[model samples]
Target: MRSEMPYANISGTAVAIPVTGGSLAALVRLPTQLPAPTVICCHGLLSSKDSSKFAAIVEDLCQAGFATVRFDFSGCGESRSASEASLLGTRLRDLLRVMAFVQEQDWNNGQLGLMGCSLGGYLALLGAADSSSVGVKALVCWATPFDLAGIRTALESGNLPHAMATASRQLGEPQDLAGLPPLSRVLVVHGQQDATVGWRAAIEIYRRMADPKELLLFEEADHRFVDPACRNMAIQASTDWFRKHLAGSP
Candidate 1:
């Protein structure tokens, strides 16, 4: 049996975006008594708040005295699947909104961190890697994809969703939020044997990142991290990243 990880619905947005014509929801898990730092969890492509993997991470973080908020990307989960036609930009905007929401919550005044898996991981670093990531104190990614255009090219010959290209092409150079110091801290964890997204992508991302970043390569791990050791490693590294940065540790 899985140990219970207490989580409560913190708030819901009536209109996530007017263009999407739907609402977005966020569920929060707070550390006991004294408020704790936060990890904004973003799920991967085609996944949602319903993903068991995300739930497991959320539970782990919460149990470790860290607060986390996980929400469904518009058109991905309970929010609005029909809006997928406009998905690419919609998800990025949704991430921006989620960040805004996390900063506003009562329990998140402390350092804010991010944990995103796969595609989610890509966007997390992309968001925080650039100067725009306000309130983003740290980042954790797993087998994250970079170079959105490359992914699009791979799918061009297939019947893959057209929305992928439409959105990837337009997400643009991430916004360089004015007035904020450059984002210098980052942590990336990827499977060296990942065949789906491949290890090359992760290395490429690592190169694009600035200093103060660490990448954990799981030698025998695959894309899903299905192996018990790999899964445990992913969890440990992610939790460790948050604890060190969010708690201001050396």
Candidate 2:
């Protein structure tokens, strides 16, 4: 049986928000039982909670007894704008807070898993590496830009003046580019034809991971995974990763 669980409208920094946008936050745990593990799926840039892939996974997992939650970044979706939303670092902090809430929930088995696309994937790894991630038993990232500084450097001297500098400022520091967590179990899926976020970045992240990681390369897909076959592959791979890692008893 499936049902709806009211989510808490948390006002925290889960993602970047512009100054002019409304409130930014997540849609918390919807009710379910059977003790199936919990997963939090995060969308990519300029995307909302109901992205086709995200919604598909949420529907599948909910039926399979896993309780799931997805929220908007400060400046995106039903939440606040990029200007008003918290900074990038603060947004990552908000993601952690969401995990804390999941741990507190009676339905969640205290084992958490993460699914993030694009920049969301980077936040997942950076934050997961830095903190004792709340119940993050496994992580699956799609097209995450792990090498942010490198990307910025490449984009330096672009048409938009101060673009690189502004992004650096928001990032708030010069990371050594060495502290990425040695991931235990991770799955990285990227489109070979992705122009926006090339597959190389995902490869770099996979290389930096600790162990028990798998990378699936899509030869003909692009950044959006719009090709029907590619989309199915991505979702199936992600679901399988979460299930294999998070499907056991507490």
Candidate 3:
């Protein structure tokens, strides 16, 4: 691990995790406190661990005494591209691997939280629902789609990545959030004006989930939360949610 001090009270480490074909590039940031609660962040379909929104949230999380892990899901950012035929499955495995890696690290306190954006959010849900993710205490999904069907047009038109388009064909039917097992504490944030994925997806996700859930809709924000103010609000809310749920984990 390559370590550097990003802040007076926080340190950042760059690490490469081995996967099927190649290693996934990741950055692990921790506060001065040892054995801190950790939050693993997943980027969007076309985004990376270095996303401004993700960076902001990671900084906030670290300042709040939470360690954060940000990594690229194969084919995006610095991670090697995965096979087009197994893009979705490969990404899921990647997340599970990262989760396991974090759990084994001495800095982790056995308490875990997950945060994901867009497609990453969907993957986060899948990861949290898996039997192996029993240690996950909370989740924050931003601009997450309840179903993948809505993006078929974008996938087909080449607006999205070819790997996802190909994987969608193999998967056949789109999976919905309702199919996921009962989730832990969840926070669903969306923008009412989101053109990519409608706001109703957020409602569906919120409704399908049990208690300890919340939905935040920004009237002027788009799918990416492009507005500076809206993005900051979303980050603050997510950081606060993780703080509440993970910090209180028993």
Report the error of model 2 at residue 182, Å: 0.2
Candidate 2 Cα misplacement greater than 4 A, ranges: 1-24, 28-32, 81-86, 149-169, 173-177
Top candidate when judged by lDDT against the true structure: 3
Top-TM-score structure, candidate number: 3
Assess every candidate by TM-score.
0.78, 0.77, 0.89
TM-score of 3: 0.89
Off by over 4 Å in 3: 1-11, 81-84, 153-174
Clashing pairs in 3: none
Give candidate 2's error at residue 136 in angstroms: 0.8
lDDT of 2 by residue, 10-69 (tens): 221233222233444555444356344778877765677768777776766665656777
Work out how many backbone clashes candidate 1 has.
0
User: Can you tell me which runs of candidate 1 are displaced by over 4 Å?
Assistant: 1-20, 81-86, 129-133, 153-182
Per-residue accuracy of model 3 over 175-235 as CA lDDT, tens digit each: 5677777685999999999998899999888887777888899999999998999999998
Clashes in predicted model 2 = 20
